[model samples]
Target: MTEIKFYRVNDAYGYLSNFAPYPFEINGLIWSTSEHYFQAQKFLDKAIQEKIRRLKSPMDAALEGRNRENPLRSDWEVVKDDIMRLAVFEKFCQNPAIRRELLATGHATLIEHTKNDNYWADNGDGTGKNMLGIILMETRKRLKAE
Candidate 1:
């Protein structure tokens, strides 16, 4: 089976990355990227959520979300995967071009290859959970079924 690995936004499968510039609307608000939505979700404060949403870049949103000064929601660890699934699903659903792009991959394995993140990516060596890639594939399946 063909394996598709993506990290940087410029890479061929970059659109599959949460950091890709695919804006999506959820919870009645527009998010700049899945990264922004995912990170912003860590907080329960409306101000912090708005702040992350308005950030200029996904990287900035990520860094801001990592600032422990803001308290993360108590259920973050338990609900994070569902949150990511919703974010990725909505991203592809709202963006037609990318939706097609995602479906075009067929049955190929999608991998978020990065060393910086062991949970969401493959840790650049296939040891990490690669949850993001798993979510993307699940999203693709849902999209296909719809």
Candidate 2:
């Protein structure tokens, strides 16, 4: 069976917002893109949406929220959990159902240039850390054992 993985935070973000090759089943519904999944599972919650709206850009906030050095840490701190959920959902949204949905939505652009490559594979310079992908792999292992 093929495994799903996401490396960089941006790579996760891209997979959520742009493209993905897998589908994730969450909350009893299959999600193709993290964007759709998160929005439905996380963002639609009134409290979470209120917190996310406080940020200038949800995407930028997720990227910044990953690091303590964000100048907007004060704002991000309030919604940190939501941001992280969005980031992590990339790994969950990996199933055949998602691929079918991506095609149905007419947004499945998992082509060459559109693929999120920063951590999907190797960096052009041969230096990269697939932090998110690594975390997901271990998490999957633990869940399967239970």
Candidate 3:
């Protein structure tokens, strides 16, 4: 099977990355990127969510989301994947250019190539779950059917 590895937002397949500057609206608010949406959802506090939303960059939003000082929602673990799926789906749907880009991939396997995150990436060794890639593929299928 063909595999498309993506990570940096500046790379060829960068649009697939959550950090890509794809502003999408969800829950009546516009998110700068899917990463901001995904990370902000980790908290139930509206203040925290707003804080993440206003951050200058997705990396900053991610950093704030990981700060244990602000307690995560009790059901974060159970709902995170679904949240990610929603964010990614909305991202492509709201951005026509990237939606076409995603649809252009055909059936090639999408891989989040990164060693920093094992669960969301390929762990740079093909061992991680690559949940982000899986979610992207699922989103692509859904988009194609639409």
Candidate 2, residues 26-71, lDDT tens digits: the string is 5454444443333333333444433433444435334433433323
Candidate numbers, best TM-score first, in rank order: 3, 1, 2
Q: Estimate every model's Cα lDDT from 0 to 1.
A: 0.94, 0.39, 0.96
List, residue by residue over 1-146, the lDDT tens digit for candidate 1: 99999999998888998889999899789999999999999999999999999999999999999999999999999999999999999999999999999999999999999899999999999999999999999998999999
Estimate the TM-score for candidate 1: 0.98
- Could you estimate the TM-score for every candidate? 0.98, 0.32, 0.99
Model 3 ranges with Cα > 4 A deviation: none
Best by lDDT: 3
Output the lDDT of residue 26, model 3. Answer: 88
* Candidate 3 residue-wise lDDT at 4: 98
Clashes of each: 0, 5, 0
State model 1's lDDT.
0.94
Measured with C-alpha atoms, the lDDT of residue 94 in candidate 1 is: 97
> How far in Å is the alpha carbon of 130 misplaced in model 3?
0.4
Pick the TM-score winner. 3
Which residue pairs of candidate 3 clash? none
